[model samples]
Structure formats: C-alpha cells, structure tokens
Target: MAWLWLVLGGLFEVGFTTCLRNVDGFRHVGWTLGFLASVSLSMLLLEVAARSIPMGTAYAVWTGIGALGTVLTGIWLYGEPATPVRLLLVVGAVACIAGLKLTAGS
Candidate 1:
C-alpha cells in the first residue's frame, strides 16, 4: 500500500513538473493552478507513503519515477531530443530503482 502511494505520488510529481513548463513562470492562471494542485497532491501522497516505507528508499524511488517520467514525457510531448546516452541513463536509473525495490524489506 505504501509503495502504491509512493508510485502515485511520483506520477503526480511528474504531472506537476510537466505542468510547470506550461505555467509560463506562473503567469498563466490555469496552468499555475494545475501545477499547484498536482504538487500538493504529490506531496500529500509522498507523506502518506513515508509513514510506512523507509525514508531513503521511498524518496529515491519517488524521485526516480518522477525523473524518468518527466524525461520521457518531455521527449514525447515536447519534442525533446531522445539521445542514446540519455535513454541509456534512464534505463540504468530504472534498473537501480528496481534493485532498491527488490531489496527493500516490506
């Protein structure tokens, strides 16, 4: 359950970060609101997940998910370059995240 919450929080973190680009430095009201809402929910879920999961593992996994998701979304939606090195690094990060999860004691 805590892992689920952490994953969801990470997803929301991705959403919020994507929204940040659309926010135009907070000058756009709608995007700003979206960013605020997503960030708030992401934080809330992360806090809930932290109640049960080890702090270091939880934070690492959460950030890993967010970072990977943000990068992929940027490449797909915003036309960011998907360089081989970047993709390889993302895969490496994914492996590390999985390793952390597998070793984490529930």
Candidate 2:
C-alpha cells in the first residue's frame, strides 16, 4: 500500500511538473491551480508513504519515477529531444530505479 502511494505520488510529481509548463510563471490561473494541487497531493502522498518506507528509498523511487515520466512526457508532448544518448541515459535511470526497488527489501 505504501509502495502504491509512492508510485501515485511520483505520478503527481510528473503532473505538477507538466502543469508548470503551462503555468506561464503563475500568470495562467488554471494551470497554476493545477500545479499547486498536484504538488500538494504529491507531497502529501510522499509523506504518507515515507511513514512506512525508508525515507531515502521512498525519495529516490519517487524522484526517479517523476524524472522518467517527465522525460517521456516532454518527448511526447513538447517535442523535446529524444536522441539516442538521451534515451540511453533515461534507460540507465530506469535501471537504477529498478535496482533500488530490488534492494529496498520492503
């Protein structure tokens, strides 16, 4: 359950970041509200998960998921660079995230 919360938190992390792109420095009211809501939910979920999961592990997994999702979202939605090297690095991050999960012993 904690793991699920962590994953959900990570997804919200990605949501907040994606929302930030449309916030226009907080000038865009709707996007700004979305960003605030997402970030708040993300942090709340993280805190809940951390109560059971090791803080370091939880944080790493959460950030990894966010980063992985954000990178993919950027490439798909914003047309960001998806060069071979960039993708390779992303894969490496995925590997590290998997490694952390495997070793966490949760």
Candidate 3:
C-alpha cells in the first residue's frame, strides 16, 4: 500500500513537472492550476508513503523517478541534449535508487 503511494507520488511528480513546461512562466492559468494540483497530490502521496517506507529511502526513490522522468521528457520533447555522459548519470541515479530500496528492507 505504501509502495503504491510512492508510485503514485512519482507519477504525480512527473505530471507536475511536465505541466510546468506548459505554464509559460506561470502566465497560463490552466497550466498553473494543473501544476499546483499535481504537485499537491504528489506531496500528499509522499506523506502517505512515508508511513511504511523509511524517509530517506522513500525520498531518494521519489526524487530519482521524478528526475529521471523529467530529464527523459526534456530530451524527448524539448530537444535537450541526450549525451552519453548524461544518460550514464541517469542510469547511475536509477541504480542508487534501486540499491536504497533493496537495502532499506522494505
């Protein structure tokens, strides 16, 4: 259940971050509302996930997913640089998140 919340939180994190790109520096009201709502839902889900997951582990996983998703979206949708080095760094982040999850005994 807690893990489910973590997943949902990660999804919402991605949603909010993606919406942020459409906000046009907070000029778009609809995008702004979507961003705020998504962020709020993400935070609330994170709080729920913290009940059973260690704070450090949960936080790392949440942020890892969010960062990875955002960077991938940027590369795919915004034509950001997808250098080999950057890709490796993203892989490393994923490995660390996995390690934390495994070792945290969740």
Candidate maximizing lDDT: 2
- Clash number for each model: 0, 0, 0
Query: Predictions ranked by lDDT, top down?
Result: 2, 1, 3
Mind giving the per-residue lDDT tens digits that candidate 3 earns over 1-106? Answer: 8888997899899989999999999999999999999999999999999999999889888998899999999999999999999999999998988888789887
User: 12-62 in candidate 2: lDDT tens per residue?
Assistant: 999999999999989999999999999999999999999988999999999
Candidate with more favorable, higher lDDT: 1 or 3: 1
TM per candidate: 0.97, 0.97, 0.93
Model 3, C-alpha of 12: deviation from truth (Å): 1.0
Residue 46 of model 3: what lDDT? 95
> Which scores better on TM-score, 1 or 3?
1
What does candidate 2 score on TM?
0.97
List model 1 lDDT by residue over 29-92, tens digit each.
9999999999999989999999998889999999999999999999999999999999999999
Worst lDDT window (10 residues) for model 3?
97-106
